[model samples]
Target: MFNLFKDESQSVNSFFLFMQSLANRNLVAEALKVSEAKYRSLLENMGLGVIYLSNAGTVISANQVAGQIMGLPLNNMVGRALTETCSRIVKEDGSVLAHEQHPAMLALRTGKPVENVVMGLFNHAQQDHTWVMSSSVPEFLPGEREPHQVFMTLTDITRRKRVEEESSLASVIVNNTGEGIVVTDQDNKIISVNPAFTILTGFSRQEVLGKRAHCFQSPKNAIKIDEALRNSRKNGNSWQGEIWHRRKNSDDFPCWTTINQVKDATGRTTHHVYVVMDITHLKKDQNRLGFLAYHDPLTKLPNRMLLKDRINHALQNARREGSQVAVLFLDLDRFKIINDTYGHAVGDGLLKEVATRIKNLVRKEDTVSRYAGDEFIVFMEDVSDTKSPATLARKLIETFNIPVEVKGHTLQVTTSVGISLFPRDGDDSDSLIKNADAAMYRAKKEGRNNFQYYRPELTTQAFEKMAVETELRQSIDKRELVLYYQPRVCLKTGNIAGIETLVHWQHPVMGLIPPARFIPVAQESGFILALGEWMVEAACRQMRCWLDERVPVNKIVVNVSAFQLLRSDFLATVERILREHELSPHCLELEINESSLMDNAEHIIKALNGLADAGMDLTIADFGKGYFSLINLKRIPAKKLKIDRSFVSEMLCNSNYEAVIRSVIALGNSLNLQVIAQGIESEAQKDKLIEMGCNLGKGDFYFPPALPDAKNLTKLMS
Candidate 1:
């Protein structure tokens, strides 16, 4: 019974011990399963890839991340040889890695750990190569001297690698590009510079690094650049503009610069990148173009365009100051003759010299500009009175007194100056210039080498002249101009000897416009030649009519202007007129003024001889009023000389005038020319003229100037 009890106790004890051991073993197993589950979860869920390789470089186990990174199925990767699965592994240099050199195999071979062994793997599923950083540690079973497997963690760094490559390529471009590039930190200190920057700024990277960007900018522009950068950063943008920069040698140069902010993912400005381009040559070209637009090429003076701008500006100032502005229009006298005789080269030189002299005479505030051919304009601003322009004019005229040596020719020239004042002559540039030109024309008419101010009277005269000219141009076509006759009576018989033809303008609106009102205008406006031709034709036709009507008439005298007589075709025009009217040339007489005959005596002689040869009578009217020499008078082919109306009218009043008339009559008789006295309004005057040996007379005393119609003319003849 004791033995049975002992055996039972031993059995129970043994069972108890066995039960305890079984419990311990169950707890251990449960803990081990939990550990394995936690490890697998860590390997699968972690961002990095984890793999277990056998000693022979085969894949023993791989987590989900490991399989995905290797581009393989987890089941297929677990049994595959790691060397075969990753056969496309290569070093960063693109050289293929041997199986022994792989991180997993190397860890196993050397019984050590491998860290950060960067390599590339070919992803078969993705059909691309992926970059990874691999680290491995050898694993062994208990009591085993050799490693059984390799535990590896792989991090896919493909994006980081690609970024590094791109960074390298960008570095190359920045280094070689022609435009300079500079990188700066957030503090605006230079952090890096490319080779192009060194070439552009004459400073090396070592010299400029860590320095402020303003160090390379001029002192004048440094503050500007800083303010611009601050504004740009505040706006969260880039700034581009031109700046003047200083080089290492302290020389300044112009550059077009662009500064861009480099921001991180958070949009915080971390650095600034500067792009600079040299623009020194471009600025120079722009300045040159601007200069050429405003300056004359020949004289280097301001041109008309710039002068106009200046005048406008000056006028503005003058208006503000309550002062006057004067515009002086100057023309070189007889400059056309000089240009024709001396050639354009010499003319250009003369113009340059004239420009220089004019510039020297004017104040710095005044502008002297070439207006056009042989014309210059001076703009005077803030003038106190008219005398300012007059004084300047006198100075300019005095300057031209000295001869200018041009092309070895010592040429003396003079300028006719015409001044027009603002608010008086004109209110604008165009008007002022036009009025100045008109005044300049008046100056030329008064005689060149003088100056004249624009007058209201001159404007009125100019308008009247223009009106006459406009009317005269159409007068012939309109036939508004008709002929009037003044009978020339024989003083002894008191009978009409001849008729003097006069032109009359039968204006439609105004009453009869006298010859005095339009004759001078016609002469100056170059309309006299046409008027003279029409008068000759009309006179010839009237004579032919009278002859056909059997009216007694000795001759018809037509007054001719100097311009008409000087025309090369005058004789032909006269002959043609006579033929067209079917009149005898002997029935017509041409009266040329003494001044016309004295102007070009030789040409006048030739013309007179031609008229005489054509059987036309020639007479010199207003004979005593001109400076005619006896030699030139005798050379004239005139058969008759008419005393001036001034001498004729004053003969009974002023003895000096009577003496002059008597002397002229005597001179005419001595020259064997018939003397005719005009303005014989009284019989006493006519008798005096007859006593003075005047063969003919015509005045209101005998017959007033009447219309040359047949009725009035036939009555006067009867």
Candidate 2:
């Protein structure tokens, strides 16, 4: 019984020792597992994709980051090698990456870290992807020569590489561009600047850095910059427009700027980029072109186009202010004499000087424009003050009292100024210009070198003139015009010297329209050529009829307009008419106004030479009313000069007019030409004109315009 008890005690002690050893072993294993877990957690949290592979190229273990980067799970990727997918293997040229040359394999074989080696990875579900850096290191037994395992680390840098490339491209563009480039933060503070910025603004990159964009604002218009910037930012858009900026030297200049906001990946704004271009010279050139487009070159003043624009603007301003405005149209009275005596060159120089003087006389707000040949227009705004326009106009008239020196010749020239006002004399540009023009003509009619305001009656007269012009165009087509003849009697024998052919209109609905009603109209519409042709042909046929009837009128006098006389083909038209009527050129006389010859001396001389060569006699009609250049008149081929009605009407009552008549008659006799007096209304005027050596006379006092009938003709002759 003693031996059995001892054996049981030994067995229990042995059991207790075994239990303690088992407990120690369990504790050691648990500590090892915890350490391994900590190490694995550190690798996974490094944000690098990590993988473990066995020596036979099979995946042994993988971290979470590695699976996520590769779009795979760590548990799923374990035991699978990257080489299992053929497409995942990287190749140089057409060959796969050698084991020693590949970053991961090289790291494994050499037992060293692979720094930055790029490669592509492929997934069955996701296709190909790129990774920038990868590393592999060997894991081996403590003393073994061959590695049992490998650790690989991979990172993605595709997005970073792309960003670097884009930054490099932007740097190149900013440096090489011609326009100035500037970068600013969202606060409008400068970040960086290009070389063009320095050239344009004379500011260094360092000087402008961290400075507000408005630091270089122009003092003249500084308020606009902040407004523009506010608009740009508030709209979350770009602003491109002109601005006035100041340089480092404090010189104001014009520049065009384009500003845009740069944003981040989160759609947050980071900076503003501005591209600027200096445009001061371009703006100057544009202004110069605009001026040339609307102004006169010779006078350097506003031309008709610019004048009309200014007038429109001025009228609006005046209306807004409830004020009056005046348009003064001035024409030089003796300008033609200067042109004739000293040539057109001197005349042009004189005109330029006159323009300068007139410009000096006007205020800065007034507009001085060249209306047309030897005429100018001045637009005066805010003229509501009484008599101010008249006072200014009088001063202008006095200003021209002095002689103008041109081309070494001191020439005296006078201007006739005509005034028209808004809301009183005219309501629009055309009406104002027209009324002013008419008043200027009235000033000339009242003997020149004065100023006059446009009258309401003058506007009525202008309307009447327009009506007459409109009627004349359709007169011939409507058969409203007729030709009448009055015999020019020989004072000595009381016989018919010749017949004067005059035009009249027997309007279908308006009864008989006198020659005065439509003659001016024909002259204005350039219908004078057609009407003159009819008159010439009619008179020639009438003379031929008289010849056929054995009536003894030697010649027919037909009045021709200045426009018809200037036509190069007028002589041909006359010859055709003479041939068509079977009449002689010797039997026809052309009556031209003295005003027409005075205007176009050279052309008139050529026309007269042609007519004289064709054996046609010319007569100067209304001679005493116009200024006669005696030298030019001698070149004219006129056989006679007709005294106008005004001169003969008051010859007895006014000696001044009588002397002028006598002088004209004497001059005609001395020049070997006959003197005829038209509009010999009273016997007293006729007797006085005959005593003053007038050779012929014809008027309503002798016979009114007769119809083309035998009875009418007999009455006209008698």
Candidate 3:
């Protein structure tokens, strides 16, 4: 009985210990549940895109962000293996990623951990590659030697990668652009500069970084560019246009720079960006073109255009100071004979020597110019009296008396000089030049190496003018008068635009008399009314022939004088002529001088408007040469505005003239009228006019005014 009692007591003690152990086990299990819930909540709410993969490549769990990034539902991935064929996987370098190279596979196979591997995986829903930074760590159970599964974690890095790629591309472009780029801090301290900036300024980044921008050199502008920044911030503008900057070599150059300031959201300035383009070459080109425009290339003397300008200026000064200005026109007597005898090379040398001698004999204030082929003009400003010019003329005639040795050839060259005094012989440059030219011809007639003063009565006496007028009246017939054509061609393409008709008298003695010599007489005698009709009829016949021959010349530009415009029957005469030749009025363009617009504007406007309504293009010739109100200009019906030859000739060299030309082109554009430039004599001039927006031009650079044969006309138009 005593032994049974001891066994029962031992059983009771052992049961009590088992109950305590079971209670402890329940508490530990509850704690583990709570910890797991907190961990799951934290991962689901986190910003990081998370995905967990098992050692066998099965997607075990994923957060919502991961599902969004992978473009597939996490619920679908929970029980599925992410096999190699399940997605298109690639490495960071965009090459195909093998199964063994995958982070999860690498960790599982090697029994190690792979951290921060960049990988690209195909998204099922988005249908594009999703980049990720992935890490895989092998897990071991208790005391196992190898990992049974891998805890593969993925974090989407697609956006950051895209930004990095774009930044790299931007860096490449900033380094390569021709214009300079400069970045500065708020204090105008240089922060960064492009390769172009180094090339333009000859200062490398190591030499200029953290230094004040423009520390090495100073421009003519204000000492501080902060004022510019303040103004720009106030006006919401960027400071731009031409400014001079100094280079590392201490050379000043002009640059077109734009200063842009960067501001924070509150408008506090934080940085500045300067975009600079060196325009020194452009300035040099302009200077060279200016010199060429005003001086003759061969003799290095002023050309006719410059001489005209100097004469105008001299006359103005002479008028203001009560001084006399003398103009001397010279012709190399028998120069053509010598040129034909010894060839142009020897003639050229002789001419150069003669020019040097003539230039040296003149006063400092006088001007010498190569007026035309084998002709030279000299003008003296602030002349004391008429005798001064006579004495100078005598010296000029005596200077060429010495033989000029040219190109190993002994040559005797002589000049014929004619002098015309300003405000006495003629008032303006044109009249003075014309009268002097006539007197030179008189000197040639009298004897070769002599000087003569201008005589107005000798120009053309009343009887001689009457005889010329009688001859012009009879020469209006078909056989005596002829039409010469010059084309207004496209400046860029050299394609003919329209044919301009010029009247020429095929005189028996004079050979060919330009209208300049006889048009004034025709106008004064009321013979232009008949002369205009004859020109229109001849042009109409020519147009019909061209049309029949299928020549592509579109329109015939006929010159209409003021006399013809003033006559009431002018429009009817044009219509009758066109009807006679069965020509379309649209094929005939009528050009009237701009001065004629002011002479009875109402009647002229009414008449021209009638023609315009009939499909004829009316052009205002010498557009800038005349003075008329915008109202009259608008009221006149015109299809084209012809910029005078004067503006076109000097536009490349003279800023004032260029401004005038630019304004006229702007006006023409605003009014919807075609702007045509005259005297496009050089390729530079032609290119300049085209750049200024004048497309159509006419000059001897293309061809002198002549009657074109059918074959050449077809070729030209073609």
lDDT of 3: 0.83
lDDT of 3 at 447: 61
Across 1-718, the per-residue lDDT of candidate 3 in tens digits comes to: 7789889988898899898899998899998899989988988887766666766677778788777777777787776777622477888778998777887888888888999999888888879998888888888889988787777667888998889878988999899999988899988899999999899988888888998766644467543365656666766757876667777887777887778988899987898888889998999998978998998877889998999999998889889888899889999875754664457898888878878999999998889999987889999998888899889889999998888888887777788999899899888999999888878867776866898888977578544777889999999663889998888988888888899989999998778999989987786566887898889989999999888888888899998976666566678888888898998888999999897675445656787888888789999889898896778889978989999999989988899999998898999999998999988788898888888998689998886787867455456766
> lDDT per residue, candidate 1, 1-718, as tens digits?
9999999999999999999999999999999999999988887788888888888877888888777778988887878788667658888998998777787877888899999989998887887888999999998889998999888999999999999999998888888899898899999999999898898889999999999998899775644678779877767678888888888899888889999999999988899999999998899999988987998878878888998898888878877887899999999976744564457898999999999999998998898988887799999888888899999999999899999999987777899999999988887888888888888878987977999999877777667667778987898999899998999888999887789988889988886888988887787666887889999988898888888878889789999976776667889999998898787888899998887664445656777888899999999998888887788777767899898998988889899999998898888888888989998889889888888788988888888888866576678776
Ranking by TM-score: 2, 1, 3
- Model 3 clash count equals 0
Instruction: Tell me the lDDT of candidate 2.
Output: 0.81
TM for every model, in the order presented, reads: 0.52, 0.55, 0.47
| CA lDDT, candidate 3, residue 600 | 47
The top-ranked prediction according to lDDT is 1
Go through the candidates in order and give the C-alpha RMSD of each one to the true structure.
17.4, 14.5, 22.8
Residue by residue across 450-540, what tens digits does model 2's lDDT show? 9888997876776776777787778878878788778787665557788887788887768888878677557545677788888888788
Candidate 2 deviates by what RMSD?
14.5
Task: Work out how many backbone clashes candidate 1 has.
Answer: 0
lDDT for position 263 in model 1 = 91
